[model samples]
Target: MKKVRKILCCVFATVLMLSACVDEEIPNRNTPLGNFEALWQLMDQHYCFFDYKQKELGIDWNEIHDRYYKRITPYMNNEQLFEVLCAMLGELKDGHVNLGASFNYGRNWSFWEDYPENYHDSIARSYLGHDYYIASSLKYKILDDNVGYVRVESFSDAIGDGNISDMLTKLAICRGLIIDVRNNGGGQLTYAHKLASHFTNEKQHVGYVYHKTGKGHNDFSPMKSEYIEPAKGVRWQKKVVILTNRKCYSATNDFVKCMHTFPNVTLMGDKTGGGSGMPFTQEIPNGWSVRFSAVVFLDKDYQQIEFGIEPDITVMMNKADVLKGKDTLIEKARDFFKD
Candidate 1:
């Protein structure tokens, strides 16, 4: 019986060796880039929102999906995948179409993970509330000219109202108010309303959020201003100036949208980073958190303003201007009011 068992083991070992020699190689299925195409399709179909620009890309969505996806897939790292995805999405010139891993397998990450840091240059530091400000917090300052200035890094409600009120009060005392949304990645819409209420004494409709429903878009206009704020009764009611750049996004963009409704509001600097929607996050089985556009924003005119809000006063920053410690945009704004 022992000899027979030994013979059977020898025969099995020989067969396994032969099979191994002839076996086909299986591709690395877990490459982050390999999943790019699948990821995009999943996002398009299952994404909480649909962007009209997807159709406007001049390429078929499926074709665009297949081509760029094939180019990006095969990278084994998530960071690499993210880099490629960011580049690809930049083509759309819209901020609403964002990507993230689903939160299922314990992957908990915030959308502001890559939000720009507020270095708070000395001039900025003199005025902003630091300890309370998170990495995404907006920078509030009282400029040298008492032209109350607030550098909104992000549109987060987590930022204390005291900080917002403090600087807004300064702006109220100033000749004109300058709300800088440049490089602000955007956050909660409630914060947008909260910030806007400082400039608006009356209950005004800021913007409307729209989502894809059935065959058309679903409009979710947050017209019911939750005006629990009184601007601390420090009114900067004369002329309000908003400093916008390409990086001013999401709720910040919505804030600009609402500000546009007022005739006294003047937007200076570059065009805003256009994203006019509320984000909804979902968790996937892999513990990854994925965020999708859950809403779209439209102004009182019923225009679904997405690719970002265009500034009324277009100004660009020059390196020389920066070296001189001069904020050309702010200077331009101050000059505008002075004139």
Candidate 2:
């Protein structure tokens, strides 16, 4: 695990160095047109997924610039300018891209918002009952049929390696384990890696990551292979099911990607809400800051996960199951263990 961490750190350091070498010289002016030009130029130079998005979504960045440029008026108010800028950023169709201001944090959330939310917190909590044990942000309990259930609400908080080792130890007696990360919006990447490490007994190649090396839309650093080393502590030897939904995003998306590589781990439920891009923040001419995806992460097959990963078993929430206070995905995972 430490070796993996060091390698990832070096990769990030390389990205930082490469970013510093670029000459991004947008003028620092407060006017609407000036801010618009600054934001457009900044995204043009830094955003990493232009080529991918162009092919996938038919987004011609140059055409986008021409279309949005006409909307910028000298007499436009800050709100109007914000709307236009937000709309322009929306063209990328990325949840990682955002425009931050005092009044709002503009984002494109169609990744999850447009899909059927297959998760119900009430139903999930009912499965946990009132006696679940809490280890940091992990809420876990043994179900009636001896299936261990762990609900990870978010990765925003740090989940130490020790916490995970202990949690797994307590649930070690179960026939199988279910890791449910339904609505996790994501937090630190290290936390995601930490939880995923326990599932694999051997060091495994998980994916590749690369950052922009030049201002050109297609310019990028050579892909760096990402690996996940086996956890130094207790590892789950039994069949493990990871339940996901459209609400699972960012670091959680990365977690699903890693677990998909493990032989014992089966991904069940809806596809994850993908935000595979590593975002970087830069200030425009105005005081507001713009956040855009600067680094790209791909799965072990070198395929894009930015559009979400498909589960090994696709399960949807049934209205009848919901009415009975049962989580359809959780029940499906439990049935999987039985089979």
Candidate 3:
């Protein structure tokens, strides 16, 4: 755990230093055109996925600037400028890209909004019942079939190692474990790594990360290998099923990526809502902050995970099952343990 912590710290520090060093000079003007130029230049120089998005979503950043530039008028109000800027950022179709202002948060959620949501809170709660044990943000209980069920709603809160160790110890008697991260929209990356560390027995190379090096869209540092060391405490060795949905994003997306590397772990349900890029924020001339993906993370196969990860066994929520007061994904996971 200490080694993993150290490595993560180093990675983050390096990214921060690199970002500081390559800082571009944008004029600090409060006019609408001035703010627009600053925001566009900021994203043009720092945003990591321009090339990938160009290929995947046909997003030409240069062309976007010209098109949105025409929409920005010197006489426009703050709200109108905000709308135009938000629309420009939306061209990338990235969930991590957001424009934060005092009045509103501008974002693109097409990543999950366009897909089938394979989760239901009411049905999921029914599976946990009213007697589930709460360990920090984790809700867990043993099922009638001797299977263990763990529900992780979000990673917004930090979870202690002791909490995880005790949870695993309690579920040790179960034949298999179901870790449902269905609507987890992500929080701390460390928590995602912490939970995934308990599933592996050895240090494993999970992926690679690339941080920007210069002002160019393609100016990325050489891909650096990322590894996950096994947890020092109690670990789950039996079959583990990870239930995912379109709402699984950011750190949750990272958790799914890490868990995908374990041989005993199976990803089930809809594809994850990918926000694989590490986000960094810079203030525009208008006092509004612009947050964009500054670092890129790729899987071990060197494939881009910024869009999302496909499940090994794709399972959609069954309307029939929901009508009967059951979660299809949980039922599927339980049935998998029986096999």
Candidate 4:
């Protein structure tokens, strides 16, 4: 299976947790520099990239210390110094980017709770129907005549088998599949790629990522190419209708990038919320972990979709249509299969 070239929401939040601290004492002014130094050293020592050496960034510790001293010598506290550090790091412009900060970390679905109005409103059914069954405990399903609709709620779940198994069973009888990912955010890019493989029978390269070298003007180099191959024992030899909205982000966006390689895929509904990139995280002292983007992704056609990815067939829901129980998005996809 190939990578989807997008990260998941949990992975992003987990990246933040890597640099986060909680229920801990604040460090002294001398400690911030030490913390930053330790973090930099740690990343150089353990980072997964092929080139994680300081020489790659063209900076020595002595020079970095001098630069920091000249820039923030007037600051009175570690907090102020840390702010400068954050600004310096943001220059990486990569996914999984972060700074050491206080954060609450746990295994709860906080995204849904924080944005209940977005998921529970009338749009939920249009995206994920109220009666949709979670078949195989992974993929979701709903019937729209000959078209079978499935809404992948998330990529990885601690309690379920995930979407791949569910999709295998449900897609067998349908003329076409409507994969709704309006607010999926993201999960594991590997899973996103695996799920996308079922829809594509031929081998194809999905996309590529370019990481920042941290040198001020150095151009990024290619990482590895993600690709897709056919899935054995679970073949969906039918048209794939992907339903997206502005909230479909990260690994979900990668799902879209991979689907474009196939001839059977068609995108419908609203544009996808684009947060496509490769993420990385490092643990700092005092249980604080910071994460950030280490790379940027380009689609197979070499387009960088950062803000959003538009639908092949655009459709938006209106208030009147909602009141009348008319799901224009689903109707549009259903009409496609009917034709």
Which residue segments of model 1 deviate by more than 4 Å? 1-41, 48-51, 66-144, 157-166, 214-233, 283-288
User: Candidates' lDDT values, in order?
Assistant: 0.60, 0.93, 0.92, 0.63
Candidate 1's TM-score: 0.66
- Once fitted onto the true fold, the runs of candidate 4 whose alpha carbons sit more than 4 angstroms away are 1-100, 103-123, 126-132, 158-166, 212-219, 283-287
Model 3, span 1-339: residue lDDT tens: 999999999999999888866554788889999999999999999999988988888888889999999999999999999999999999988889999999999999998889888888888898789999998999999999999999999998988888999999999999999999998999998999999999999998999999999999899899999999999998899999999998899999999999999999999999999999989989997789889999888889999988889998989999999899888999999999998
lDDT of 4 by residue, 228-273 (tens): 8777546677888887776677788888878877888898877776
The better-scoring model by TM-score among 1 and 4 is 1
Give candidate 2's error at residue 337 in angstroms: 0.5
Clashes of 3: 0
Top lDDT prediction, candidate number: 2
Please, what is the TM-score per model? Answer: 0.66, 0.92, 0.92, 0.65
lDDT of 1: 0.60
lDDT of 1 by residue, 1-339 (tens): 999999999999999888866552322244564345444544554443344654544534456566676656453466666656555544444445555554212221222234332222453343444532322365555556766666776776465556566655545667777777776777787777666766667766654444544323323334433222445544447888988876777778788888887778998887765666566664333334445566656777766666667779788775575677666777788788778
Q: Output the worst ten-in-a-row residue range by lDDT, candidate 1.
A: 103-112
Q: Write the per-residue lDDT of candidate 2 for residues 131-209, one digit (tens) a residue.
A: 9999999999999999999999999899988899999999999999999999998898899999999999899999999
